[model samples]
Target chain A: METDLFEQTILPHLDAAYNLARWLAGNEHDARDIVQEAALRAFKFFGGFRGGDARAWLLAIVRNTAFTKMRAQPAQDLGPDDLDKIEDTAPQPAQVLERAGNIEAMRAAIAKLPVEFREVIVFREMENFSYKEIAELVNAPIGTVMSRLARARAQLREIILADANLRETRS
Target chain B: MNCEEVRELVHAYADGELDVARSVDFERHIANCESCAAALRNVRALKPAIRGSYYAAPDDLRASVLRFPSSPDGVRQSGGLPAAERRAGSWLLTGLAIAAALILGFFVGDAFLRRSANQNLLAEITDAHVRSLAANHLADVASSDQHTVRPWFEGKIDFAPPVEDLATAGFPLVGGRLEYLRGRPVAALVYQRRKHFVNLFIWPGDHVTEIRDEKPQRGYNIVHWANDGMTYFAVSEISAPELRQFARDFTTALSH
Candidate 1:
């Protein structure tokens, strides 16, 4: 790949790369460093990247970098698998804040999701990558992508709205 | 499509990611099912909430990220000089470098009296102030250990800026370092005089010195004034009163 095209097309996605890295790293400094390293790798391996979902390809690199860092770290605080444990309780946004509500809880909810579900949500919801692009990026069958996305939305809905008594408490 | 099928694509439906037939079916479901309509609204609200968390890498990251590209600065590097223009361009660069040195000497002469220097001083200072805020390194010289902080600058900077134990006074000396601010290398004297960061940038420059003392950009209260043979810019997000106090200590550190 010529440097010019790489500069124009792929370079534009650095923020997307950083956003994914920030989530993966769970901090600002590491996220910044991770994206730079990922960019270099992506730039070097630009030839291997097929066109279409540049966002996903970048994300894949970020995921790899994040995992590499994760492996290198000493005992890590592994958050619970949110997707597996669907609370029977319903979601309420306002009340979540006052009673044991924090940003990490919301983040943990997103983070705990299954990777398949997480990827679809991050791409579609966070990065705004479309189904076709996500399909291309993750190298998934479009049906799998669609289903994962569906599951992701449903899961998010249940988790977000799970604090059923939030409105009552707020009122 | 059935209601179940229509519901499955509500996200796509909301995102306009659906095609003609699918969109029609999804809308029909939404029109009939009040639950689906409310679900759509709630889901839509999640987007903006999520967006609130989207933070950009510091503005200076743009320079570092896009630096090597044929950026505006890159254009300057790759000067369009035919053989005839080559000499003119070389002279321009040389003249600029010379002018920069003379200008820098006028302002930063006292602040930084050094041997030869490398880099674009103005851009680096600007870049440093910005990068510091982004990196949370606005103060390079941070320490409760006054002895450690003061002597630390011995090997690093040509001058020994005073390091005082200001923790009791609410200003603690953080560690100091040599960093590339704007584009030129400068002494990034860091001190946390309370919650705010004091980024004291010392480098040699005259042309951009005038821009010093310019009104603070954004929330950064900056005073760019040249002294001691170097241009110095002290910046912080702290209020004008606090920053000025920090600046006073910053300049007083130059006490020989």
Candidate 2:
């Protein structure tokens, strides 16, 4: 009975959980490990679930698991503190849009965003979660989510433009 | 809204996060402001490109996840992991379990003096309503017939939850599911109001704590009332007046 409930509530979110873990961990092998570990933790904590958004609940577990791994290897990704080190101003909007169409460039730009910014982007764009949902998922205020998403977009534009410039220079 | 305010809010305006009033004001300002209009376009441009980067789980990962609940000790017991990897995984799992236990202990200890006990109770009911909608697991027994839905709850719960088809009143009975609220099994009856879903949770109670005022939380309206030793909490995104009417109609129908 418990297993049936677990499958019904949690299994449907497997891809979502894995996608969040994959982006946060930044590698297929580590993402797989993080997801596996998170699944174990989720099963253990299943009894305490008082009924709410199952996808959000599962993704929260996945985020915690990924953060635990990242904590062990702090150098793996740029943490929130590293946000200031990157340039705040993006390149020209036209330049950014020119490069946005390139799938690989967009993917790489997203992969290069700081963990905090990357998460909001993934939640807002890939998962199609509302800002309110993103705030709850990240345990932050809605204003904070908005600013982080803005900063994430700015940084993504910068990265894509830089890629465009590098490709132009080479050609 | 001025250009400065519009600049700060253009992203939210583009993202559809602004409330209707603010959105109307924002559009009015943006219509005359070229820079603000450009800002909205710039923010909107990233969406389609970013959506293309979504990653799906690999087949092996799906297989492993499917194995998680079936295994007695969960996924850590799944085969094919190196001995050292399994050891490390179990160590991490142990650490997480201990941390979770500590958090749970703290919450249990602080469960008392929860500042207005009724508020917390309503919050739990609200959460269950959201869960029913979010999980798409609205009903364990899907039946529009009141007789079928009423008898379905017989052995699963200790109390008989009042069920009725309110279709004639513009709120049709859909189904009912067994839910756990405050550690007791309760019956959650699903009803449809236009495109909205109303979850009416009923459980046996001795006290008649009639809720005179409706409660609104997280964009959902809730109406709770007690009759004949059964407490009912009906939660939905529908208007409070309509939900209040639902409560009245439900009680009126049950009295017959």
Candidate 3:
């Protein structure tokens, strides 16, 4: 019966779980391990699921699992302070338009973003998750999710424009 | 609303997260303010472009997650008797109980060993299948023609991946992609069966052996075999019988 509940509820969201883990862990190998661990943890606690939006519930577990894994390792990417600084320097419209359609650059910029900012962008932009859902998943208020998303976009624009400028000068 | 208020809510408005009355007021304000309108346009344009850049989860990852044992205690319990029963029995009946326990332990140990090994491999291939679909990175060289797709893998991988157009058999060739499995690069052939996508991972086998096994993992039907110096794994969401037909058709085409 427990196995049936797990297969029916948690198994369906494997792709979403992996996607969240990949972004958070920043690589495939770590993402794979984290997701496996997260699934086990979810199964152990499946009885407590309370039955509302299993995808979000599974993702919350994945998010927590990934963070725990990240904390165990030393810091890797830009810290939260760097994200806050980038937030202040909003990119111009011309800059964003100039970098439009540059998929590789856009991807690189997103990858470089601090985890907090990167996650909100992915949840909102890539996953098409709503503000409310994201708030609940990330365990933050709606306002925090909104502002983080806005800052993430701002940071992405800044990085893309800077990279484009660097390429232009080299040639 | 003033520019400051409008700038703060621009993302919310563009995302349709705003209440209806606030959205109307927001639109009204943006209609007059040029910068606000431009901000809204930029935010809107960012959505699809970003959405297109999805990172596919690796297939092995999916398999591992799917096959994750429901509970650690469940595995332990399935392997043997409860702790109290074992201790009591050990004291009461030494002769017959020892013999029975030995027989049961041997079978249980053998089954557990074989299961863990098979589970590892199944997890890897299933993960590859799920990753391809999730990442939307199904094919590196996508073509229906055997001529174009077959030659594409010549120098890219160690072996020539057999690219066959199985359209006549109802399994239409979609394309082929490069995948890494079991520490070696293998060819993953994509085929369409109805709306489902079948990922057939092929690699050069060590010897000539005709082996076939089927397992259903996490609602996916996975058929694996080794034949004619090449190992094949056909994985999909299709039914077991249908997937078996696919595997048979694929092997026959390659052998001939």
Candidate 4:
């Protein structure tokens, strides 16, 4: 019966789990290991799988795993101290058309965004999950997800527009 | 609905996830309002751009994942092809397809040989890596947050992969990606060495498997070696030299 549930419910969310793991782990392999192990464990302890949202249940596991690894490591120095002045300058209409060609710059910009902003944006933007799904995945309420997404997008706009990391000379 | 209420649902709308009532209500409001309509258009535009930024993993990852058995070795395993599913037509069809592709891609000459219908495990591993990296669908759990991720491994594996904060080592731990390798789930610790990713696939290194040096697999530099009898692969888009350097550093960190 448990194996049946594992195949039916848990198996479907493997990709979702892997993506969330990759994002949390920052690469492919670790996330794979994290999710695989999480899935295996999630199955053995099927008692916890008393499902509201399987994706959320999986994500919560991923979040918990990432948090565990984070605690074991030494604290990282916070970036720039203040992320408020994140550059918000938009590209010139002409230049925008030119450099906006590739997705690389956009990825780099998003990578530079703070975690709070990045998580919401990545989940909302990349995963294509509903607001309700994301809220449940992050263990936050729907309103918080909406607000964070708004802030995240606004912050992303600021970062892209600001182009703080890039030099004006390049433009 | 007001602009704020309308804007919130715009994302929801772009996804086509709104219910019949709310969907109709929002559409009616958009019909009346120009600013809201323009905002919807702009928001919708962002979707493709955001998606485009993501690199989808190749089909093999999905194949391996689907082929993967979630049950324990105490149950079914993901190693090798299922006897029932291993038909000659699949391989023959694959071979014929590869041969057909070879003719069109004439420029790809001697450099890229025709892949045999029989999928090589090594090739599949590399394909899985590329496919995983290409897709935003890579990690089952995405976070730079290691805390929330590592514990999910407990009770599932007997060995720890020496997962730690390597930020001081210049590779800030990003998150983890789950991989099905060698019939078991191995944790791939994701870390950033500049822009490239190191996929440290760790499993208990027993006498069963032999380790090898970093090799260039399908253009991606792969550092496949064992430390503490554990297997790890640090793969990245960066040059082989840089990846090797990062791998050596990771090895040293693991040693201590």
The sequence of per-residue lDDT tens digits that candidate 4 reaches over residues B1-256 is: 7766787677567556678789889999989987778656544434434543443333455444433332133122322224543345554554455445544454443223223211233554676577666543355446666675676444334445667657777887877655555223467777777866666677765443333444476777776666566766666777777766777777776667
Residue lDDT tens for model 2, B1-256: 9977787777787676788899889989979977677777677666645755666688788777755543435445433334564565565665565445545544553343244346756887898898788656688678889999998766455567889999999899999876655434478999999999999999887778665445688889999889799988999999888999998889888888
**Which candidate has the highest DockQ of all?**
3
For B1-256, candidate 3 gives per-residue lDDT tens digits of: 8766778788887676888788778878988988778777667555534654456567666554543342233233322233553343333443244335445555555455456656756887898899789756687667899898888666445567677889988999999866755434467899999999999999887655444556777788888877667788899999888888988888788777
**For candidate 2, what is the DockQ?**
0.19
Query: Where does the lowest 10-residue lDDT sum fall in candidate 1 chain B?
Result: B110-119
Rank all candidate structures by their lDDT, best first, as comma-separated numbers. Answer: 2, 3, 4, 1
Q: Each model's TM-score, in the order given?
A: 0.44, 0.55, 0.54, 0.44
Docking class of 3: incorrect
Pairs of residues at least 3 apart in sequence or in different chains that clash in candidate 3: B56-B135, B59-B127, B59-B128, B60-B127, B60-B128, B205-B229
Error of 3 at B136 (Å): 27
Task: For model 1, report the TM-score of its A chain.
Answer: 0.62
Clashes of 4: 80
lDDT of 4 at B135: 47
Task: Return the TM-scores of chain A for each candidate in numbered order.
Answer: 0.62, 0.84, 0.82, 0.69
* Candidate 3 interface CA RMSD, Å: 10.3
Better of 3 and 4 by TM-score: 3
What are the per-residue Cα lDDT tens digits for candidate 4 across A1-171? 333444455554566666666656667766655665565446546676676766567667766766565453324443332324222223233333223323555566667765555666767766656787777666778766666665555555555556633546575
| Best lDDT among the predictions, by candidate number | 2
Cα distance off (Å), candidate 3, residue A138: 2.1
Report DockQ per prediction, comma-separated.
0.07, 0.19, 0.21, 0.07
